[model samples]
Target: MEQRESGGMKILFTGGSSFTGYWFCRQLLEKGHEVIGLLTQKRENYEGIRKERVERLSCEMELIEESPFGSEKMIDLLKKGTFDVLCHHGAYLKDYKSEQFDWLYALETNTKNIKQVIHLAKEQGLGAIILTGSIFEQNEGIGNVPLRAFSPYGLSKGLTFEVFRYYAQLYNIPLGKFVIPNPFGMLEEKRFTFYLISQWKRGNIPAVQTPHYVRDNIPCDLLAGCYGRFVEKVFVQKGPFYRSNPSCFVESQGAFALRLSREVSKRSALSCPVELKEQKSYAEPLVRVNAEPAIFEVQEWSEERFWDDYVAYALEHY
Candidate 1:
């Protein structure tokens, strides 16, 4: 366990049970920051991967379970506790991928009591605020024309940032936007990587849709390291707003799947053969990725540890 000798800021964080949230908070803790995690659901309510995430986070830092963002419990904590940074990371996820996804509903929930949160941070002399952004958001990162959000859920995230940034600007608070691309590693949701491993477990080859879409995928711990470094630097910069779009493995989906398969082959007994389906659907952008490419190289010791942990988790859980 390593720790920073000085500048260990106290941070109020939400969404600790989320995949990236868990890694980001852990990185901060490893660097000696005090993290007070605010979990949206009661401890008992989380099941499956989310449950395991929460349990791991609980043993590491201060956690106020069932304390959703904008809830009375969170408001009370802000009023009573003096924090150096406020990190809002939670979001609504039901039907997030569908065209029927309600961005307005998510917008309302995401921004509820945002003004008060900013106000409290201002009064408490909080050094800065960090809000997680998605590259899928319209006009975010580098991408094809418009950079239109991949789905309604992405639009909601973009709007959510606007609402938070608006209030933070009003108070002249320093705000840091840490834009997330596709982060995959241990304790992640049952997404593309999970699907691949689970199919292998069933002795079936997995097919990748939207194989030609140029996207960004990075190890979660590496992304978390970026977040930790960004926070440490955000306070000193003279700014009303700052942002970092961390990118890694920026390539076509088919190429990325091949990279993943090769990596799995090196570390596990599974050959992990994958097929790339002819991409017919193009609802999302063909090129959408983070603005900052390779904040940390993919060849670090942490990246190796990432695969070790990831493959083990996949084999045991899938």
Candidate 2:
């Protein structure tokens, strides 16, 4: 890898406007790294959460719009790349929670320029290719007796990594896999956390359907902080291949909902309530969580500050 400045490295970042992606970009910037966000969607589609993320991040860094993963445009950018690293955080997320996800299409789209991109990484002297992974994918992380993939999307993610890792090996370049567990925070999606907060705001009691299944839920900033440190470690150490599973809150869905309720109620005026259903669905894994933790630790994290930020975001958006 070639050295440019004395301080931080420049990264070609994808998925900067996504919920997690947005947080990751902010964390990277806080660590003094330069983030050149390559957006997958157009300005018109950058509405709601994406729009908010784009608007805020645009003020902080450079953003190139409408660049899909493994596309001709992205490859062209890589061809002229002067980045220290490539952070591939964007994945095909349409219907990602469904069972009918097209793994083949996603796989093909994710690695269309696999060979060329790896070649470029070597030729351009990029430090490493960091691929964002998922803990729900089969054989990833710890826990989950069998550790089977949660859905077709998980399968697709696992497969995508396999192909990317294969090429990285072939090119003899450094590659790192940063596996993500469930991340929640301010400006996040209307997921379990948001759903519960919404119910509390409307004086409704929310029910957690998959209450019994154990999973990992983490704070977004904490995870991003860990990632920021991970990027630094990548250049410092020799990484033919490496992976980091950043784990935090591990508990049942029902317990997690109640936990959120407690945090929100203590911090805000809203009274939150939750109900844990008799989980009858065994479609997903019963116990699936991450293995590694130190790879993504944010040294400055404070639980109190996290809730403060979380409540502030909720008050504004919700």
Best by TM-score: 2
User: Against the unseen true structure, what C-alpha lDDT does each candidate score?
Assistant: 0.85, 0.84
- lDDT tens readout by residue for model 1, 235-312: 657478999888888999899899888878788888889999999998788999886765443234365677888888
Those runs of model 2 whose alpha carbons end farther than 4 Å from true positions after fitting are: 294-296
Q: Please state the error at residue 167 of candidate 2 in Å.
A: 0.9
RMSD of each: 2.8, 1.6
How many clashes (backbone atoms < 3 Å, residues ≥3 apart in a chain or on different chains) does model 1 have?
A: 0
Number of backbone-clashing residue pairs for each candidate, in the order shown: 0, 2
lDDT agreement of model 2 with the native: 0.84
Off by over 4 Å in 1: 1-6, 296-302
